[model samples]
Target: MSFDTPDDRKYLESHEWATTDEPIRIGISDFAQDELGDVVFVELPDEGDTISHDEPFGVVESIKAVSDLYAPVSGEIVAVNDALHDQPELVNEDPYGDGWLLEIDPSDESEFEELMDADEYEAQIA
Candidate 1:
């Protein structure tokens, strides 16, 4: 099945989003959470931590395996979804909403170009 990439956000091949807003939200894509089965835990970076593009920002543990959550853009983490610490299943129930992982203040807006658009990312996964 093809996934939908909302026009408002930029997507990463790793299945994260970088919004063009003050605080960028990061979350696993619906396709990703579906493939992951039940999300058991999400180990994410703390606020104020700097993360590099295409690098592992944290870990997402599922019943199937532990996957690294990659940064789609370089930035300093501004916030994290505290709810996931106690209720990791949120990632499965709402991969694009309440399941969001973190928010970052991007270091550079141009770095977003390195990420794929909806169609390109869809082709890569296909």
Candidate 2:
């Protein structure tokens, strides 16, 4: 099935997508939330937490399965989606906007540059 993948963001092979805007906002892709069926819970890194590129940073639990949330770039987490704790379905409802997981101050700009662009991400998922 086709999924919404905004042209403004870059994506990881693990199905996480990151915004090109400042502070590096991130979340799971539309295809990911759909595959998970319904998200029941989300465990997020605390603000100020240090996360490494391509490393597991948190977890997203769904009725069908639980998945590790990987960081697409190395950075210090600046903000987290507090709303997800009470409303995990937002991940499925709006994966790119209100459902965004974290905002980071990237340690490596080169890493964000390496993440798959929208077209490349769609091709990968296809």
Give the alpha carbon lDDT tens digit for every residue of 1-126 in model 2: 899989998899999998877899999999999999989999998999999999999999999998999999999999999999999999999999899999999898899877999999999989
Error of 2 at 54 (Å): 0.2
Pick by TM-score: which candidate is best? 2
Candidate 2: residue 6 Cα off by (Å): 0.6
Q: Count of backbone clashes for each model?
A: 0, 0
Best-fitting candidate, scored by lDDT: 2
Q: Any idea what lDDT model 2 has? A: 0.93
For candidate 1, give the lDDT. 0.85
